[model samples]
Target: MSDRNGNPQDPDNGPESPHRLIEARLQKMAELGESVELYPYGFDRSHTSEQMRADEKSLTEAETKVRYPGRIMAKRGTGKTLFVPVQDERGTVQAYFRKDDLGDEAFHRVQKLMDIGDWVGVEGKLFRTRTGELSIHVEDFTFLSKAIRPLPEKYHDMSLENRCRRRYLDLAMNQESRERFRRRSEIIAEIRAFFAEEEFLEVETPVLQSLYGGATARPFKTHHNALDMTLYLRIADELYLKRLIVGGLEKVYEIAKDFRNEGMDRTHNPEFTMLECYAAYWDYHDMMDLMERLMRRLARGISADGKLKYGEVELDFSQPFGRIRFMDALQDKTGRDLMAADDEEVAAVAREHGITLKKGMGRDKILDELFSELVEPGLVQPTFVMDHPKELSPLAKAHRETEGLVERFEMFVAGFELSNSFSELNDPREQRERFVAQKALLEAGDEEAQQLDEDFLQAMEQGMPPTGGMGIGIDRLVMLLVDSNNIRDVLLFPHMRPEQS
Candidate 1:
């Protein structure tokens, strides 16, 4: 059924649904118009549920002094007494109402005005119930805000798609959802604290860029009306952070939101958070140690034992992380030396693994697909896959010991790439050649190609020190740490397709 506004309604709840409940609530507001201000300015809450619980033993049950506010989540009893679970940010407590204490007229008025989703401030004293539940005995109550529309039904109309689209409902109804987001916030704070202690300057980079480079991914594009030039949402923070390195900022990091014109999956999102860090005079080896320490710290910070369970896989961060050269690991998985393989041989490997690439994608791209299919999943524990092909790492410095590889390491965990680091490419001429090669790939139909940003090249020419730069997908890391299955599970506002009308 359609509403008066021409919006779709749930077929299962034709009339006695959220729509009818909202209509009933609107009528209640109309009836109580002259008697109450349903939407009050504010409530001066003296104690949160947590504070009340902390002082649970000190406060007298007979005395009434505390002013507490929370949303009425659940209600019980239809007679002269009512028990409702009131939830604040920290936790929930029960509010006990008696008609004798409030009188019949006021009590009946409350029954008329209050609903499960309404916010209320209670003037009450802490007490222990007959069942020993910590609760509040109300002397007086004030309506804070009326929830005109009821919450989604517990079992119906609360699908995953609906939850993502209407996160407010999900958060209100699901405590796990609320706590997961809180954990996300706390994890981020811990990261900032860690960086600060290590003396890395937390910095912000431009989200809107004239040219996007630093990653092999397409960027979201826009045009600025005032400037009248095209602007692309940044896909990586590596280039700008390296520019700061050129400016002689020894250590810099940015916790940034990067936008990518990409596919969405359980692990991938179009828009995501990234923690990019760069330090001068450090190589990928140093970065490997830093990442391992950071991960160990973060894992222990969230998990008490530095061990985590993601799905059925148990990851012990307390153990030393495994490391392997990228090409060697691929050869072990494929039983062929991919580096020595010709185009036809590599194409055969790709076909064997059920991999399909864009028509003109480079050999390295094909190799990456094959590894992603065969090797990435078995890298269940924390593992460093090091020294990728120079063709694959356009921004990484060439491997000093190897002929055609770059000093790069990608950290993988729980079947996903968690972080990537490089001994940043600093030679201006070499960097130019790398960009030229990437341009050739771009023209050959590889859409995820780096653009030659002259401005950045000039920064490099002015002299950038030997620097190690790393980018960690904050969402993906949060997922592994929190055991959240989907990218949307960790993100409060994950990108979603529009609801069908």
Candidate 2:
């Protein structure tokens, strides 16, 4: 058949064939309604496929009737009996349908109208097939929902781009993908449970704010119609969560959606989930212990021996994660003391490393570029790179022993910085100075620099106790736990470019 443009649009052979298949399914739907009560949708399910399988050994054929709802995954047999595989959220089970049991009319209707990808309510009893596979013997059935379009062929091995673009189809057709998301949920639940057990209250903060600070990231701006003011999607919940600490809600955490108007990559998503937690009386040292415990807990939840394998690397979370001072590691890697280097020296070092220097780049930015390019990628094991230069950690408390350094650490694993923690700077005067410095960076063309939030400063002036704050990239953590190489793998719907029409 030809398309609207009169081109040779092979409806049977070309890209438009899927539309033809949809039309065929729609026609079947219309025909099926002629004889039977189509009851195209229902949710009265007695047992999921997994539950039925678990209870299969105890269930006797024709004695324990079961009502299950699932999508038809595959079909076989052509004569009086048919074996179809049906998949629910939990798992898949083979269902045996006999013409004698279902009645000739219903069997004929199913034979003519039922298609793979259609949702069906199956009333059956547990039975073992001739091949000894556990299955359901169909007594009666109902067509739950019609799937007009066919699922992708070999969906489990489909290209990443297509899989992400049609995530619902991916979830429907790919059991591994569904299980990965299920594990993601389990991990998040465990994390919440861990925090709650530690007496930390799970709290929520604003996603939209009049002013954005807390993290060094570009903000996504929006306008509040009622207030007639510009609002920004929060890049981090750090400042606000700390304000709660000041208000005597000492132990608090938030698992929230943080937006950064930034580039996307294997580890970075523009919109991502972050777990930001704060403890009023704690410091960075305490945070390090908490982080280690948390990682071990997550690792144990996934693997019994507190070990997790990401790609080819097996990480031992039970072992104490290694720690090296940030400047020491930078110098060890680059043979240059970044803390002692002036801007000219840092710029020269950056040039030596073949790093691109942005216009108006300061010493800290130069040092950061050098570390990311030369040092970060080699951090394969679980390690804490600690004691950052003050210039790189404005929100962190200055190190008591080190003159120009702050008590901050970034936990790195498999070359990805999973979490950042700081012995938070609670001195209002010092915080104002840091904000002023950040403002200077903002003026000097650093769009990702932290903003000077006067309100947060005022809250600080109201006397917040010494606190430790940590922010974890939950997406990156999930990627590590699930052995997913890309951040997009964990995210249900990551940001993507506009599809060509």
**Candidate 2 residue lDDT tens string, 184-298:** 9999999999999989999999999988988888999999998999999999999999999999998999999999998889888889999999998999999999999999999
lDDT per model vs. reference: 0.87, 0.86
lDDT of 1 by residue, 313-355 (tens): 8899988899999899999988999888888999988888788
User: Number of clashes in every candidate structure?
Assistant: 0, 1
Q: How accurate is candidate 1 locally (lDDT)?
A: 0.87
- Lowest lDDT sum, 10 consecutive residues, model 2, at 1-10
Which 10 consecutive positions of candidate 1 have the poorest summed lDDT? 1-10
Off by over 4 Å in 1: 1-19, 60-64, 155-157, 342-344, 348-358
